[model samples]
Target: MGVLSAEGVLLRRSATDKDDALVQCAEALVALGAVGDDYLTAMRERESQISTFLGEGVAIPHGTHAALGGIRRAAIAFLQFPEGVDWDGQDVRVCIPIASRTDEHVDILSALATTLSDPAAAAALREAEDVDAVLALMAP
Candidate 1:
């Protein structure tokens, strides 16, 4: 369970809505073998239950409470939609999809919140040209 790297970061993505963004992010996690196919369904279900949009043009999506069993590893998939997407009532420009087998989800969300809350860091992430830039913003 290492920190998310370039493999989990997607930049300049095109997504129409929250569903599209969620699917794209979840697919990235699946490709990384961080979670099973069931994770996608669980993520959608979780979204339907409550919007993960955390304001600040960001959204943190994760599987349902009961879908923890499908998590094989702790990882995050970040999708940066330059065009933005309609996340419930909020406009989300960044999507962070998380998959974890333990309580690490809380810590990750806390860290992400701290980073995203900073105008400079949030802007850096949205305007980053490469994965390295994005990674640096996340951990800086």
Candidate 2:
């Protein structure tokens, strides 16, 4: 599968808290066969060290260098929490979980950053109704 696919785009999700949201993101990545089960722990550790909240109701959750060995392939899972989740004080509606080896994540991050830099694009992603809409908005 590609970095972002229709299967990776999930809408109308809900999380009770930040950790819950992270867990859901990690689980989605695991389900996609992008990362191993231990990836969840790595994601939590990364979050504890620093906040992933990128503003505009979005958060990017990814594993750390230590978790690189568990990655099966590079992929991204997009989860939209319609009710929103509290991410360190900021309310986040989107949680994008990324799994990559070496420096591959940098390129993925750059592309996503560019897409999210536009207010309209970010808003569209947050409120996207289906996977196709999300794919279009996130298209590089």
Candidate 3:
């Protein structure tokens, strides 16, 4: 299965802070049976250790090495906050939460980095009218 899915996409979500964004995306993965409830905590811990902000209003949040037990599979959850989130010092509008168990993390991160590196793609994501548009951006 692919890392992204309809159930994992969120558009114009309202998150007060980083923890809120983490919870929203983690819950999406949990709903898809990709991760356990502890995934949220693990994601938060990872964020605390290192900033996930990738610039261009995007942040890819994932669990720490110790939190691997919480991941049931390799999956990704997308969250869009039109209002933007204060990710450390960067204003992040797109949040891609990842739950991975294999070496796929590198591949996924690389792909995401490539996509987010494009100014048009990043802008399209921020202005996306629906989930399908976001999915198109994530499509390989």
Candidate 4:
């Protein structure tokens, strides 16, 4: 197993629910930058062709290594759309954006699965009104 834990993952309270998935994913990409140089732009470029929706009112937007400016680290973000974002077949109110260029990415995904797989966490996130409240759900 990898070192995927809820510590680095987060649940967020987005200001607006009408945000475009592309935009939300891009912003998350910036925060998880490894190359650290214009990572947002690179993320958009990577996202131009694909939708990273993971089903269940959630979307996982991914950026390739080229767009990441190189290096590998998993960045996780929890986005709660007040209304919801149109994604593929379903409307997503919750999104988890993750980017990684190394094996650590696996750990991130593992952590994500472990955390989100919990019914309590998902329920809490849906009900949480603010980032602080969301973070509490992940608290030990």
State which candidate has the highest lDDT: 2
In TM-score terms, candidate 3 sits at: 0.91
Per-residue alpha-carbon lDDT of candidate 1 for residues 12-83, written as tens digits (9 for 90 to 100): 899977888888988989988899877889999999898988878888898997988888888887889988
Kindly provide the TM-score of model 1 when superposed on the true structure, using C-alpha atoms: 0.91
Q: Give candidate 3 misplaced runs (Cα > 4 Å).
A: 105-108
**lDDT by residue for model 3 (25-59), tens:** 88888988999888888888888899988888988
Off by over 4 Å in 1: 105-107
Look at candidate 2 and tell me the lDDT of residue 7: 88
TM per prediction:
0.91, 0.94, 0.91, 0.62
Model 1 has an lDDT value of: 0.83
- Model 4 scores worst on lDDT over the 10 consecutive residues at 1-10
lDDT of 4 by residue, 14-111 (tens): 53332355565556555555335455555566556666666556676656666644534656666677567666556776766665665555654554
Question: How many residue-pair clashes does candidate 3 contain?
Answer: 0
If the candidates were sorted by their lDDT against the true structure, best first, what order would they fall in?
A: 2, 3, 1, 4
Point to the candidate with the largest TM-score.
2
* Of candidates 4 and 3, the better by TM-score: 3
Q: In candidate 4, which residue ranges exceed 4 Å CA deviation?
A: 1-19, 31-50, 71-73, 115-120, 130-140
Name the lDDT value of residue 2 in candidate 2: 81
All candidates' lDDT scores? 0.83, 0.87, 0.84, 0.56
The stretch of ten residues in a row with the least summed lDDT in candidate 1 is 103-112
